[model samples]
Target: MASLLFYMSATVLFAQSTVAFNCSINPIYVDIHKRAVHGTDIFQYGSFIGVGTPAQNQSLWPSLSQNITSFASLSYCTNNSTTLKECTKSTGGFFDASTSDTFRELEDFNTLDNDRNGTFDGAYGRDNMHLYTHYFETDGASETRLTDVTIEIAQKGDIAPSIVGIGRESTVLDALYAQGLITGKTYALYIGHGFDRAKGAVNGSNVFGGYDSGRFTGEVHKYPMSPDTKNPMTVRVKDIIINDAAVPNGEVSLFDQAAFPDMKSTPTPFQAEITTDQYPLALPYQITQNFIKHLDAQKDNYWGDNSLKLKSQFNGSLSIVLDDGFTVTLPSEVLSNWSNITPIQDRDENSTSPNYLSTAFLGQIYLMADYEDHSFYLAEAVQKNNMVMPVSWCPKTGAPQAYQRPQQNAWIKQGLIGAVVGGILGGIGISVCAYCFIVAYLRKREEKKIEKDLERSKAAKIEQMEIEEAPEFEGPPKTPKTATPFFWKKRRS
Candidate 1:
């Protein structure tokens, strides 16, 4: 009996597990706040996280390459001759070890360059971290807290601000998975265009363990993670084309040798890393030169070596075709406007120049990374939608399919239809069973009646035979005959 009870309990638990798996898998959606970072004119999208014992909120950028989360220290601003408010505005917020009792320094000040830009002096430590879904939450009700998380306090550096690394390492995603806040070690990002809320700029979002399907459009291309673990999300560019009235087909490839004969060499397909640490699309020197010549652009000494300004007006869209046949086209406004200048830059024709697609590229495409599977996906970004559909990756299948919501009345209608159909089928089955049972019972009753008649007929025949075999004499004569037969029988014996 105990074993039977155990089996029954197991069956119930299995059914519950099945139901949970088929239901919607909710992912953690980290919404980005649109505002300008300190010391920069361009409006940036960042998430607000709390740190320390009392939960001092800090705005931090999501780094795709770095694993360790770092925040600018209060000393960093003083060293740079900046005030606390300005520093706070610039670097999200500064970390003050003196204020937090839980802060523990793990390593002394040392130079670190994890961002690949340059080196900075900082101390490694552990502290409490808080992540929230909304920016305006002050009550800490929605906070997801982590204890003794590895963090950095940047004492001196030219680093922009605090950054939460979501790379393939022991990062926050791993911590979230460990805490059961998310299902898997996966995340998706879509950096929408324009930061000015007054000018109709849409905000972007970062999701953990899932993706927002409404933020992207078209077919998604899946790419295997590069064996080079440091730069796993690398893509190859096939060609760069732009719309030009001067060209025969109303468009021209930047790689066209005849059109730009002065290029250093024939342009070919090349690999580039996708990163969020910078904002320019770094390309080969030859391709950058081709763009410069076609657009009648001149170097902007004020901006930097790679920055350029238009010498002649050109209204044409720039399209980048990937080796996988996915094309992302940049509108003319993104190419022409001064605010959006320097979208493309040269990766100096040298051995050390790294070819990469920077944060600007992410502004046009949606990126989803699944570290557990060592794969990533890319799709064209959409800016106008307000839909916030977050879908999870199936733990068993490793597929991130969105949970499609049926129409408002669909479930009810389907349920009613199913009930009516099932009822009709059930009724037909029951009636057929009843008819067969009634026919069988009647046949059984008829068989029993035939048996009774046979028994009665046999008994009547026996009685009739007995009557016929009786002696022909009357009652008085039969007694004398019986006595004579008895005496003869005794003598014979």
Candidate 2:
């Protein structure tokens, strides 16, 4: 979710010992996408994919015809908020089939229909209509594709233009794995703290099959990735603490389920998932009200936008207790802050939901996910500008590989324990241990590689499987119909 289920680079210094993953990072842009006609065209808004073929709406973008990567003409669907009429103000864009030779349309439908809600909802409740399938891979990160991969084109109204899906089932990552572009099924992210003017222009990284160790410091807290891959990644939140004082568990829910009709109405201890897509730390209404009381914060308009703003004099930090016993304490700045809200479809621009909630969708925290082991690491982020970090792939744990036996390490074990106890070490003691750990790790790695190589050299002859002819891509039926909703127009809300 931190990678934008709907949703890193370079070798740099880390203040503490960290794990390096074998992943590749690419430079991505965030464009605001306003045309010159509005005189509001230049600022950038974050997007997973860069410029593609020109769309039908190319005329709207005065600069579209000049850009080489501009291949497809963007088409604007009818705005379903009021009437099913063509949208003139909507600025959303996507990869149009008429423009790209390698574009292959698969099926278009609501991907997040866990509750049979007849709508698509991200883990944090960001709703949109999606079209998914494979396409030719070019540009972006060189290591990203060895062949064609799947992509999800989102029509999220004005909230998000279009973003690449990095979820478990995303075929883009799958294509990378199937072609051996990456060693395993994994990706890493570093969502920076630059979503608003106060933080300024901040860039984050997205890596395939690994994570960059240089972006984070302190003891990394590793938690098992959720087995339910279809749903967004979720963690066990044991409790919430405000200023060293624990909040009553039954008093308020972790998130606002009212937006989700199928979900329970009562408060639950830990139902929240980690996400980089949503800005606020969304919470139940009751809990949010309670927190406001705790901060003794008064409501104020953010700029002239009149969005939810809190003027709090309290500066104490907030701590979250994970199911694994790891407690992460966030400073007041991150725990209590504001960002421009992504307006929802059919909702008043001035009345978009609260900016901060009990959801804990804070971007200041650093996270690392390992898809193979179905686990991820969490820690406070250490921000650096123009930073680039490389990833290293460690041997798989709890699972055996083609030429390697399953392996485990005390580093992870000790790291987990330390995180649980909040026993982060510093000074010479930590430095000495870090040195020893690196030395032992390198030695073990070299030894394993040599041993595996020797085994391959002495192995007997083996028979290879027969090759099969590739199947042709026959597009979906002209009138394919089913319970799953398909729309080139409006989302079935």
Candidate 3:
């Protein structure tokens, strides 16, 4: 049976309009383990959260953003020819027919399995358009934090997925920009979520290479004001969220040093009595869909007043079958054009006392709202960093406190000035040259047009002359032939 699920987002400009969301059933669920509060749990809503009434319906981005704000379908987009479609009669997921192996078979076996098994209400041909959650937040008037913060995977079925879930991963700002996600440059949120809590330094285990030399801190987030500020420690970083991508138990940052002096770093030293606490999940999540929507605006179409509309299409869809038979359908994930992860170097690269050298994983994708915003994120950050470093990463959208917005009019005025200058130069050059060299060629075109017209005129005149001349020949048969009796005989051989 064929099924059609319609999704429409009617939104106004960011500043003038606020987004109010109401789905037939948007739900989200979060499950958290509290180490500090012992035996406690915290739940935050997510993806399926959009399916229900607005539990949290406040604009993360304001009115100026309203003009460009968007709600996108999250999933995978494929060439369709890249992977063959395999019809399934059971709970649906991406089943690679070529190898008959699932993504779960490749990684996160049990967790993946658990997610897959929970996805069906017994329909054979449900076009599962799964929703992948990305954390977004509006803090104060400056709206901040749009990143791959919390990534929850869900599908629409007879039942809805829960929205309460914790976020994961750091902000993906720079990568998003290069890929063109958000527009006008906004802040991004990086999230930290899992169990446990701390208010101080979190050291890493057995560090070898860092800015200050080979040091080891075995924790995450070590609060500077902690009682044991100097001692190695690991404080919980759950409240620190970058964007939509959350940092699960192991996804916290591999900081130059722990948030606390006693914080955590990845690759803990293999030793006894070296107190290596389990870290938050290492947040390395990427979206499966990149192309959100292609838009076009028509003026004066509505009420004869100025207004605009957007046209969008989902590239394609993907299937996810969790271990427990939870099948989720999603659109294709878009990819940032391949680029090198250039090193972040300070002015003292060759000097013994260099300023900053981040030990970050190379090639992390940062998603922005759009090209302009991406540029602003980088440009502003560069200025803020005082251009001291050659290159640095951009923060994601929705996290504005970290940045200062630019004046819009000044930028536009500069463009107008440049255009005027170009116009003047072009005009002057045209006046000086008069395109003299090509005068003959242009003249020739006119000449050809005239020549064709003249030829037609002459041809018509000649025809008229012929008609006038015809009367002379028709006047009388000059010297008419006389009848003569002459016998001719045919001789046959």
Candidate 4:
């Protein structure tokens, strides 16, 4: 029999400021060799979370569910823009709300007003749904469950269906905080590679109020979270160093066109968000091309369909310099997905449209997010053969202090040669630096404007539903796409 771990009282003096509980990261199934009939990638991956009675008995929507057991991420009813059957069918999961005694309906709000009519669409087409469970648990340990233990359904949009709603305002996390189920609004993530284990199971880690230090090497590199609450995990990258060369040069443009035509080079000092939902780190084509060339990596095409991929048998590291003078270096093992060539169709059945397949997964990157103080920390991962639970983070202060390193100053000092600089150096040197900064700023600004324009233009078209109208299925209804529905929303970028 499994034992339940109760929450600690407020008066209890924890050894650490943050609390960490082992997470259950279930690997959904995928067929990497054959493409789906819906023009999706040959393979797709999603995480599994417990819902309904007997926790592990049912999986979440958009995940790989077997035995006809799973909960719908989005819910809906008759007379909606998308039929209930259509919504559930699209996600490739099995869900039946009518039979479950614990089923509860709520509003459905998707990533965007997918349809440009100034209205919102439910998950795929289904509205929000929740169920009661004896607290959430992964493996054997009990997880922090929100009120009603609800799970929002999402059948349509840019996000992967297998994700847990861990965003700043996600009702699930909010409820946990309101109920005093956690020490603070903090969490850590360690997404293990899917192909690493002999059984081919994912062993990723997620802890709600603290982190497990055993998952990372060296020390944590603390940085201020982005002030933009909408994009809290944003990181301002100063430059991308491949191996040892700062790429984006005219020479690297050759490989840029190999993946797609006119692959623009990404300028330095740009912003990127850390998204666990994606597998690849999203980089501009030009940078990707440079990454390919320097690493001697080749594009994969198992079916000879001119598939875009990053392939390399060699080893290398990609370093990201932040504006705050911190550096994050990722090993080739963490960045390479060459062996896995799953490509998801992003828009309008145009197989080559930009999508999650393009973004690089933060594999082996350990992350610590403190939502209460609006800060997060990151570190290079160190994989362990066995799980080790350290003492829970306990701090006497109101908020846990950030990590400090004695070598950080040395690293920044060496980086002063050409990296992020914001001071008055020798007269001529300062003048040249100022000139370069101005040019880079203007170029980055132009790119931002272009990206925004493209996003708006694409949002309308990509929001269209491909489901058959009045489709009949032996299951619950679809989430209503009404003019006004209040529910959870997240920015995936």
Worst 10 residues of 3 by lDDT: 205-214
Descending-lDDT candidate ranking: 1, 4, 2, 3
RMSD, every candidate, angstroms:
21.6, 37.2, 29.0, 40.5
How many backbone overlaps does candidate 2 show?
39
lDDT of 4 by residue, 270-319 (tens): 56666543334545445545555555555554523223345434344556
Order the candidate numbers by TM-score, best to worst. 1, 4, 2, 3
Q: Residue by residue across 113-177, what tens digits does model 2's lDDT show?
A: 23210122221211111111111113222212233444333332333333344554554455556
Worst 10 residues of 4 by lDDT: 26-35
Most accurate candidate by TM-score: 1
- What is the Cα-based TM-score of model 2? 0.50
Residues 1-493, model 3: lDDT tens digits: 1222222222234322222111111111111111111011322111111111111221111111111111111221122222211211111122111221211112222121122212311111101112223221221211222322222233233212222211111122232232343221222211112111211122111000001011111111111112221111112221211111222442222221342243233222110110111111111111100111111212222211112222432233322222223222221221110121111111211333211101111001111122222221110111011211111222222212223235668647579877888899999899768877588779999999999999998899888864234222223334538865544444332
Name the 10 consecutive residues with the lowest summed lDDT in model 2. 59-68
lDDT of 1 at 342: 53
* TM-score: model 1 vs. ground truth: 0.70
Clashing pairs in model 1? none
lDDT of 1 by residue, 1-493 (tens): 9999999999897666444432354677777665443334534457757688977676677777777788877778667643333444456666777788789988554423354553346788888888766623232336678788788887766555588877778467877777667777778987665443112366677887778877777788888778663557888999999887777989989988988887667799988888877666778888887888888777664434355667766678888899999998877766666543557765455646667787667778889898866888898887666567877753334444433456667657669768878999999999999999999999999999999998998789887863244434323333563556432222211
